[model samples]
Target: MPQNIVVSQPEDLTVAWAQRVVKLHEPHTLVTQVDLVSVEVGTTTRIRLAVTYHAETALPRRWFVKLPSLAWRARFITALPQLLETEIRFYQELAKAVPIALPVCLAAQSRWGLGSILVLADIEEHGALPGEPHDVLSAAQAGLVVDGLARFHARFWHQHGTVPRYRWLAGRVRQVEDHLGTVLAVPLMQQGLRRSGAAVPVGLHQAALHYARNRRRAMRFLSALPQTLVHHDCHPGNLFWQQHQAGLLDWQLVRIGEGVSDVAYFLATALEPEQRRLCETGLLARYAQQLHSHGITDVDSGQLNGRYRAHLVYAFEAMVVTLAVGDMMPTASNLELIRRTATAVEDLDAFAALPI
Candidate 1:
């Protein structure tokens, strides 16, 4: 079961967080009901809250609120403008011309010492997780997701030299690799393998060391790719399908990176190994077709296959991530961390599974 990770608060709360949410969103009328406060994983304060509007309002909305941790907020005081600027830029790129559906950016706010909050339109639930572990997505739904990726990427194809501003977006992948290095990398690798009843194979540590040394090369390889607006973490957990539309959420890691990185990370982490094994080629072909529809006819099937290989550049990232988060492990999460590490390396050896 997923734990509702909540923290305690004193009754005399000085800051009016509740009022702040309403003001940030510009409520059509004052919010009358705010219940179902559920906490989510983050180094900072993140929650999903349901807000009911005025007495007659029927179309109530859910908003996902993400705020920095108290500690993070303190360090960000001096650098506040830069941090907010980067975030605004990302949202602008994703929102401007793309016809795809993302959580509408209801609000992005910075209240000085209180840090920043990004309030997003929540994708409503029909029900939580209707699909089977390997239940296939309907053809149309898959097409929308893959097409969305292609559209976002094709926007940047040849504009590399011309659009100087977008050049740095390519570096977002490096920022990701760096962030994961601290929170999810080495420690989880050491932990996940041993817990899965998988032996710590010989040369594991050496391989890890080598991977670290070549980390720059791996990052460079991604930076070398045609950068585009990538929804860096688009696993099934980050996606929700409702009738004819699909809602893509969780934009914290959104940045400019290789398009394949999103496809790879999403498919690898979201699908069962069996599902990925069966559908990898088929999905890639479809995504390529979508690219073609958008006039990106330069890439052939051979180059498409190459993106599959390049996805492995993020294998270590996925391993640590699976360990850091729950649900991947059967027993103790931290204990099983070692198992996830070994399994990630296993995929590195085998040519199966998405790089995610």
Candidate 2:
């Protein structure tokens, strides 16, 4: 086993560390410079590295690094231990098996109760860029994302029990349910609910309350559906686009759950209401067809639709909790996400779809 490298600060990214990262991709590559390009600190510390090599080599000129946030509040809110363990394990153990594109993990290390460091190939150089949070995706762009998600989910469909390696992907839903009450009771959650009243649809207001009140039931209903690996946070900001196809970023929330939950969340948060309405059914069909192509023949269309409807509420609940606990993005971006998701819930009659 390779020993884990300890890196807690930007200063720790020395030439030796750069060499290690480059060696994984090209053994003969020599790293000459590790220039810091940008630093973003939120739930995680995202740093962009501009590199200089001693000679022409296969190593990328730029890389992206993810490390534990230095902020005390962010550290507390993010549950750094679990988040780091999950992301590192995904890159190390599951990235190869996934069919869709993901950032190439050059180096990843995690330590319980401490922090983690992840170095990855900078997809930005490959024409991939993060989706703007406030900009809703066009119908064609949304279709590509759904297709990628379907391929990703189909790769692990119904294999959770058969594959011991996937056992780690379990338990996130239960963990969320276990902590839902505390999350709801927090002052931040209450404040967010009060501030968001004007944006939430009148019909779905009571539905949101139902989910908050009947947390266990809501979680159980979604969890009981067909299981597949899902990017639990598939919102626009965690996705990147290049050449009309979408690639996922931020694997911290990866889990084993109903794959339609990802679809519902993505459609609700990433599309304008008009675009979603025009393209949702078609996108769902596209997703199902992709699954079919991957030999997943048991998913009934009606059942999938029902689950998609129910999971819209799941997406709404998740956004509420997210907006409550932390400043997930800029205020305008976060509010837009809440508004769009609420609109989706009411439009789909998601409250009636899964009556508590």
Candidate 3:
């Protein structure tokens, strides 16, 4: 394949293209074969590849590649916002500066009409375990993730505009996405709640409906806080575990936002309600302390708690919206997340925290 050639699906990853990508990292190596080990399609198509080299090298045998979704609905949802493109940009431009573990980018490229390709070192090859959406985290595991996110948030704390290079983190694409989300909020939320059946408690339906009706205002309220780089979709499935350390994945929703939003989303989606109730306060304190250790000292525990409670609304909405969209995640996972987030919202009175 030529330098200009960009693959759009697992089948397009020809040996020639594989060689071309490999040669960039290992000058002496030539790819002899390319085998598609497995492929999973959701909002994006994740392809696991096995590459054989002509000569001995230290390069990984397996590689992970992400492409735009093959599912039409998922593709349509992500296309306008250029979610995969944004993630490609993250790998190309900012992955190295991140504090926690992330897959090593081997090659990343995007073209407006040609689509995008992200080649990464398969973390499984490095003995890391990928987190599944249905896996509930123990309090100890959730605490580790909270710590990792704190370090990440602290490094980029309040640096949104000051860092000219990262100004795009809060750029127009996010604004447009937020606008579209608000526009679709009511129908999607209603549909999701209906689809949720008995998963969401009856008591929370009116509050959820009201929040959906006033989503634009709710969005504004959520953003009216100190901003930092956040993994806006911080559920368990988007994480990987290695030696008890949590590494983040799925940068498609990475953007500038209140850092506590990540904490709220993670806890709501990642933990069992009982476990979350037991450990969230301590984990939150640990997050603040981690931020302080990283020289971010202005965060107040009381205010942080309020922000966290408020942010749980988005977490609930996100899962509901995912369910509404369909095909974006497993129905079972989506329902469970909706259940957990709904419970969190009611438990914390998350909607009350919103200005609306």
Top-TM-score candidate index:
3
lDDT of 1 at 310: 62
Better of 2 and 3 by TM-score: 3
TM-score of each: 0.71, 0.91, 0.97
lDDT score, candidate 3: 0.90
Which candidate model has the greater TM-score, 1 or 2?
2
Q: Put the candidates in lDDT order, highest first.
A: 3, 2, 1
lDDT of 3 by residue, 3-96 (tens): 7546877898988888888778777788899899999889999999998988788889899999999989889888888899889888888888
lDDT of each: 0.53, 0.79, 0.90
TM-score of 3: 0.97
> Which segments of candidate 2 are over 4 A away from where they belong?
1-4, 23-28, 171-188
Pick out the ten consecutive residues of candidate 2 with the lowest summed lDDT.
180-189
lDDT at position 136, candidate 3: 98
Which window of 10 residues has the lowest lDDT sum in candidate 1? 5-14
